[model samples]
Target: MTRSTITGTAPPEAGATDPGRTTAAVPRTGRLTPWLVLALVVLAGSAVLALTIGPANITAAEVLGSTRYHVLTWLAEHGLGFLDPGENPLSRIRDAIVWEGRAPRLFTAAAVGAGLALSGAVMQAITRNPLADPYLLGVSSGAALGAVAVLLLGFTLALPLAAFIGALAALGATLALAGIGGRLTPSRTILAGIAVAQGASALVSFAIVASAQGDSYREIINWLLGSVAGASWSSVAIAVGALVLIGTVLLASARTLDAFTFGDTAAASLGVHVTRTRWLLLTITALLVGAMVAVSGSIGFIGLVVPHVVRLLLGARHARLLPVAALVGAVFLLWADTGARTFFAPSEVPVGILTAAIGAPVFAWLLLRTRGQS
Candidate 1:
């Protein structure tokens, strides 16, 4: 293939007949803004509605009230008593359920969703691989290994720390392997990641089979399957912090990602430092994914499916694609987790299972659609 074909762009002399050939074409920002606003509104409404869901009998009004009550209480405690809304309206149980249980879990879900989706979008663009997700680098398996090891060792408190460390280690290893023979290319990176993932999976299986017992076994299973059922304020803080800080960097690289879709040589010709940019973006994505997986284990599909769905609606330009994808992803996972919380009633299903169940069919549909379009 010529450079034009490889880069998905046609030379002027070749004729501009294939309008859809170029991947870097920017769409009108005005057309995309409404989608962004609608996604934001939907995400906010979904979060509140999700809070009101579950076995607990709570309403949207009550959820809002609880949120207001907490804000006021915090303000009062911080010596801004004048801003306090007097009197606690809800009973202790309701407050605890909303504040202590559901609120953190819901926020964590949203944050993780946003982060994963952002990571997946960047990954797909950077590698020019549509099937890539946050876990394509073996980060998720490594995290599971660390978390599982801790659970078996009776160090459940250190699960998040261990998981994050393991994810970083896996990232390091994958990069090292990918760079060993020559310049790190997308295909090499992917192969190395698969190798690391398989090795980590093997270790995790052995550890679980040999050591896990009783509640530890169940805990290991739950975590591996991914759940925010035990999410606390701390989980919310980590997930949201990672999303905001790292996510900003990723979003800022929108134009860089757009250039990437045009192939390395094309991007280089456009004055992008392809190797440096790829390394930087990949490392940043791993850190964000690590923080997310540490808190929520390996929640799948939000990363894989959200971007494709958003791209179908908004097109492939990264500027329009990134933020809107985050919002839609937040809403998607928020509801998936809500279903996980309520669908089985008293026995909560793992959110990961729900995402996979939902993601598989959606992904297949996306593949068929893409094929038809092509």
Candidate 2:
């Protein structure tokens, strides 16, 4: 079928910003700006609510008041003394809970969610696979192995750095395996990733068995299951930094990604450097996923589910889809992590478990719906 037929719309106008692009058709009754604004507002509200709903029993008013006071204090410290009104409404403990504990975790959630969703969307587009996820490249498994190794071996290197290295190593292995005979086909890439992920996971299990002792198993298992409870300002920095650095490049390459919807041959015909672009986008995605996994472990399904939901609402234009998916993913995960922490009260569940529980059902429904349509 032609690109237009597949997209269910004609190609964009020649003089349009995205000329010749095939954006998925959705109803044109509503403007994108309003939806985007709504998503942003929801995300902001979710972050605040997540901050308030932790085990401390803090009120929304208290959270807001504390946030305001800190903002004013920071401004005052930075030569904008006029911004300070000299009122401290929150106690030190409350401030610590908000600023040091919940706030960093929430920020990390937003960054990780955004990065994973964007990475998944790009992966699906480039590979033309509905089931593609950030972990499809074995990055998450690789990261888990790295963290387990560090824990077992008592390595002085930070867990995040080690996990990032492991993720890169897995990506290298995947690429090498997939590109063995000729061009990297999607089937070959997926199979290679599966192999790498299984190998890395086995290695992680071996490391745990050999070195993990008593409570070490608890720590290793928790990290593997993925929790944001341990998030700190450093984790926030790593997640946000990776999102900004790599996410920007991915967003800038939206046109290239959109072109890939029509396959590599069509993308090449449209002046896209198909091979180089694929490599560059995949590498950037791997880096983003690795950094996030380093901070939060391998939280699943944000990447797999968020983009598809966003596409349903906003259509398949990467220009619109990428940002919207990021925002929606941020909101979804902020709430999901909040549930993980608060749902079981004093005993916290891993955020990854919650996502999988939620995502697996949703994925099944999506699969059935797609099959019905076909």
Using all chains and alpha carbons, the TM-scores for the candidates as numbered come to 0.91, 0.91
Structure candidate 2, residue pairs in collision: none
Shift of residue 184 alpha carbon in model 2, Å: 2.9
Q: Residue 97 error for model 1, in Å? A: 0.6
Q: How many residue pairs clash in model 2?
A: 0
List the candidate 1 regions with Cα displacement exceeding 4 Å.
Answer: 1-29, 155-157
Clashes of each: 0, 0
The parts of candidate 2 lying over 4 Å away from their true place are 1-30
Best by lDDT: 1
Worst 10-residue lDDT window for candidate 1 reads: 1-10
